[model samples]
Target: MATDSIGNVELTDSTPTDATAFLIEPPRKRTKTTSGRRSRTNFEMLAWLFMRLSGIVLVFLVLGHLIIQLVLDGGVSKISFAFVAGRWASPFWQAWDLLMLWLAMLHGANGMRTVINDYAERPGTRFWLKVLLVAATVFTVLLGTLVIFTFDPNIS
Candidate 1:
């Protein structure tokens, strides 16, 4: 039992059933590392790094997009099909839009993966959710890329 700012509360200890849930000890006490699990943590580290870097880039890319589309020129009223066609005609704008699309989609997928990992309790549910997330992400990215690249200015 414990009493704090909230009120009386039961303090119970929790032990994880997963085999990988173990306290870190001194290097001398450490056991042999599993070969099968190599680089799993590395992937997580890369994902974390990607999130931070992508977020920074997204801020600039998104702000620039907004500034160009809504703040500069004739403002939102200037946005039209012809304007978009003219914009996409440039390779520079195509590359910028493509990079933004890929980054935003991947960033959102990674965030959702983190959420599914933290909140979902069942392993099966989590696996399926992640599978669905990947499928949706891939589908969206492919479709968006295709649309961006294949857009025809002459379509009436």
Candidate 2:
């Protein structure tokens, strides 16, 4: 084990596998205090954490939604235009669906963004892909919100 000037054992060369050579070089001492480039912020960390939290919340929201829409009362038979109108008339159900839509889309989109960032090696490609992802996410969320708020059952 080679110790730096600070006496910390370096693990850089400890791995002898041929594949390890292709990996990013171990950070050098200068990198620890480099000032030119901005360090990674907490956004990615928060995004990962959010994915986990949202996934858990989505489980409950989805299950409750499934139960109410597909398993309660008379199952799918109870779900008619009037049933939907009545449900949407209540602010509670509207809020529930809205939350579900927003959370699910954001969670799934962020997950895909992470995947793209990891796999897309080119900066330009990643930029355009993320732009498309953001546009789609925004469009879907906005369209769903509009439909939820503007649904008019009384219209003949």
Candidate 3:
């Protein structure tokens, strides 16, 4: 080993090594320099976990909703405003719908955010896309929640 001008000890390969070995670059040494940015949090890990859990719950919720609203009794034809009113009148159904609405909206918004983050090349474009996604999600969730809670069957 010989000391180079930069103080790095260079290893002289005296042996006739394979030609391919010379083509590979040495691994870079990492320096402990701070860029003044905060360290990464576990937000990505938590989001991944939430996506999985919410997906499982959404499957059950969506399946139950489809079965109850489409397969039971006389099918879609039987579903009217009165039918919806009656279903909403029950606390259990109300809770179920509320949960489904919230979960679906949140899950979809998160998925769209991920897509936008992955595909949007420009920082400004990504920001605006996420903002639009959040706005739509909030509006839909609020409107659905209000309708579910304040539904009245007496409207003639």
| Per-candidate alpha-carbon RMSD to the true structure | 12.7, 10.9, 8.7
The digit string of per-residue lDDT tens for model 1 on 13-101 reads: 23344756665863443335644446545888899999999999999998999999998998999999999999999999999999999
Clashing pairs in 3: none
TM-score per prediction, in order, is 0.73, 0.71, 0.75
State residue 45's C-alpha deviation in candidate 3, in Å.
2.0
Q: What is the C-alpha lDDT of each candidate?
A: 0.90, 0.90, 0.87
Question: Weakest 10 consecutive residues, lDDT, candidate 3?
Answer: 27-36
TM-score of 3: 0.75
Q: Show pairs that collide, candidate 2.
A: none
Which parts of model 1 are misplaced by more than 4 Å?
1-41
Which is the winner by TM-score between candidate 1 and candidate 2?
Answer: 1
* Model 3 C-alpha lDDT per residue in residues 1-156, reported as the tens digit of each score: 467799876667433466666646665444364445546888878888889999999999999999988999988889999899888889999999999999889888889989998899777999999989999999999999999988889987
Better of 1 and 3 by TM-score: 3
Candidate 1 lDDT = 0.90
Q: What is the alpha-carbon lDDT for the whole of candidate 3?
A: 0.87
